[model samples]
Target: MSQGNYRVAIDIGTTKVCTIIVRKRADHRVEVCGISIVPCDGMSKGMVAESASVTVAIKESVEAAAADAGVEVNAVYTGLTGSHIESKNRWANVPRSEGMRPVTDLDLSAAKKAAGAIDLPDDRRLLHVIPRSYALDGLHGVRNPLGMHTGELHIESHVITGSISKITKLHNAVFDAGVRVSSMVVEPLASADAVLTADEREEGAVLVDVGGGTSDIAVYHDGSVVHTAVIPVGGFQFSNDLSIAFAIDFESAERLKIKHGTAAPELAGMKEEITLHPTTMSQPLTISKREIGQVLKERTSELFRMIQLKLEEPHLADIPTDRIVFTGGGAKLDGFLNIAKYIFQRKVRLASPRGLDGMPEGTNDPAYSAAVGIALWGMRNLPAENHVDERKISHTSENSGTATLANKQTAGALSMIRGWLPKRDKETAGT
Candidate 1:
């Protein structure tokens, strides 16, 4: 936490790279100073398949953001996602001292260890172990039991886990970009931090981040992230479908999907058509817009169905219905909300990153939500006393000279995990 006021956050997605800079004011309000987005290459489904290429992409994006913000950033909080991430729920109980004394730090530590002792895959590692609620004796839902008196204490928690390899790759990629990796936050979790309100988390909510190669879902109930998963399908799949259906190159198909695709074909007139330039064919072809919509509908509906099925898991089914918030690039597709409503059988709305000042209007798009959220996350999580000396940070084209900053900072992780815990009502606290 160098007395530096600015923090940087980066989201390296499969299809796009985003960087954002935020300045924390004296009053604790965070302002966005700059943002940059670049089409991603050398990445697939949130994994760095080509490390050098990703390093270059990161370097370019970060430099652009630095220019816009009028300051250089030497370290950043990065976002990670993929199909390998998994989550689970567990509980722990601690007995009070023989005299039924108040809880102590030792008791809390024991509870955390108990909750984290659940079985996990050999190849995975725990990313977050978030406490949801604590019970003292028979009284449940106690938010802060630190000073409470009880014969016994019970804790329920959610544990989020991810592949160690994926995390390593993310770190290496950022390191190669000539910047220190301050933290590695799951993409959906970062997005939730930026967009979802505390009320939404407490009331029960789901955040769906639809990116190019994956759609990450985070379910929050009682102010804790109870479940998180990544579906290996996204906007890129739609583009691939269009390419195969229209006999066009992948680039052309992507352009067509972005410019002309829709989720509902029935809305288009039967006689309506659009001109398409198929790469294999020398002549321009006229295709039915409804036909394009039909293909998109098939794929997008399948995605929605998968999301529904994931939610139907017995453990997550209890979450309330009114708080499903959709964000990310795919959420911007035409008629996506209506399609989501039809499939999810619940109220749905688009969530954009907001509440920050000085961001370009283009940065307000849902496509940039994760990026903006990452920046805000950096602002809140990065230590206020840690600052990178701009003079020491080299602007050289090569990444070989950047020193990896060993981050011993723990505040960001605590704040992120705390945000997921249930909040106590004033009346209940008073009582």
Candidate 2:
């Protein structure tokens, strides 16, 4: 394997911190060079509570990954999630500065900069401003307007923001861990990139990543991201539910869920049972698997229902996508997709990273999708960022540098995303 470019991605979830080292081969396929996954402490729902504990968790994961890859890393592309993260569509109309000149990437950059004028609360700051589409004059839905003469260029983009305190806590934790946050990627964005195919993006889709601590959503259409959000509820809730119902330790409960839980209880055998030791007793107790499945089904159903309400509140109920793609650790549970289909009432699919070379054993699962995708995101996006945060970074080009705050006003400019879908149904239709 030729060492072309190697990158590290760190995903800090409520239950664990994972660091992955991926190396791009000469043929452009990525390989898993190393991996480190450790239980996380001092975090809840993606927000860092205790900096010292988070720092330790990050340090251990990165060091373990480095040791395995036989390469020391000083910086990383870190994933962020939580209810604190928000996104919206925004646009900026830049009159051709040159007066009837061919639009270039610079013009596009200016439009993106213009769209950065978001009105965020004092507690929040911009994390990412991705150009969604370009429009020249009145002709719209242009992927790129470069090399074409136009009097004005309109830039529509998706801006992701996070709480100032939450952002700072994450930065401090990584810095204390002896690494720099090169760039920030929304967890759902990375997960979508890794799991979604080109058709999924161009044809419209919603990616639901049920991480350990949060469920991240990325709605894509027209080959770009239109909306992104984070829900604090996640797979942890399932484990918690089981723990309370069976009076077992959290660890034991989680194990039970992974091994036997299902989102569709009717599909499970009611007579099936498993015995486990309770936290307070040396004696083992037998529990019906049917009961466990019922608990899981209820929890997951409630989770999807909440998500549905949020979408409606934002008037995103009509996001143009026929399929709902589920990923993340929770998606690993049996019958999760069936539950999603039951709620969304549209086509549903499971997603994971595809087309990788030398993928490590047990690393190609949906759980690793974001880690793999964020590394790829770091590779493809390092150039568009002219100024990045002053952190040690990889895959940086001389043309790109700092990660600074983009204004909030540009957060919701011109926002229409298009893609393929099953013919709209009257019962549960897309608008």
Candidate 3:
């Protein structure tokens, strides 16, 4: 594709809708040319609850982003997440060609077909079938097997499937807003693309994204996503707790939480107190900081504990706590990393998305990590090669069999390597 062609990514998150525009440069680097975010009025946890409200919000965000980038967008790669979605790894075996020659595109295609053959509810559909790795004979971890001689080929993948109705609703909403849905990516996957490094993913790590209404987790090992799940809790729940406990309005409670909330009450001094304005009372009320901390700790700990339980699942046992990386709006909370460290009993660090140009200071906040990552993903995954060389269309059709897996693995591995490599060396390396 021409370097000037702009790609747009829309993150229809729970509490906010964000749109980002990026362009691929001659050097193959992606630059964030524009961004726009608006409060989500009719969506919750990445699902559209009110189509009209969501359509309006999406259109406004898109228009704002287009205006900033000085270009119009005809289609967008959207993000999707919710408690209803599920992801799992499955394996499939495909036989070699009749002559028992090297693995062919047909074999890869067969493997993908097998992986996508899982039984699901009538209202569900597969969103992504990401190959984790290929196995030739008994040798696993084979990244590319196109020309490799093997009698049997085995493919492992993370199959992401979601509610068909929800996905359809999202498509319709975007369509109503006068845009085409080029693709739909899982939210955690997009966030992981934006933040986590390759070494972290290979060495085993978990990415936790604490958005306004939900906490999404993706576990990685050996440079592939092993598990992904969502917890129905986030910063918004903390605010709700404060609002109810203090008998105050939501806005006031949010302010207090942002200003004074802590995940550990034992660390707060008993003498400390915070003022609260109750909804019914005429006078402001004073509440102990320790008490507020205790409440915050309870809810956050519950969320973390659920994450721990998910980690306990056999599929996620390889994830190491020492490699944990936290992102999202909630990661910005004061003392949150401390609390996460205490609960997980390991080193924890806040992760932010990088490698974009023209991003505003505040827009660099973790809250925009997913949106920015989506933009990067679009630039990298969209059919750029098709646009670049029309003559290569037939090659694209042949490679589509393994392109999804290869692209994701390449992206994941390159990101991990970039995080740990020396500045000069990483700059010279290709993603």
Per-candidate Cα RMSD to the true structure, in Å, reads 10.9, 11.3, 10.8
**Per-model lDDT:** 0.73, 0.74, 0.74
List pairs with backbone clashes in candidate 3. 197-416, 198-415, 198-416
Angstrom error of the Cα, residue 319, model 2: value is 3.4
Enumerate clash totals for all models, in the order shown. Answer: 8, 23, 3
* Segments of candidate 2 deviating more than 4 angstroms: 1-4, 313-318, 384-431
Q: What residue runs in model 3 are displaced by over 4 Å at the alpha carbon?
A: 1-4, 278-280, 319-321, 385-431
lDDT of 1 by residue, 385-419 (tens): 33244553333322221121101112222232223
| Order of the predicted models by TM-score, top scorer first | 3, 1, 2
Off by over 4 Å in 1: 94-97, 104-110, 117-119, 378-387, 390-431
Encode model 3's per-residue lDDT on 353-379: one tens digit a residue: 876765654566788788877777666
Residue 328 in model 3: shift from native, Å? 0.8
Candidate 3 structure, TM-score to reference: 0.86
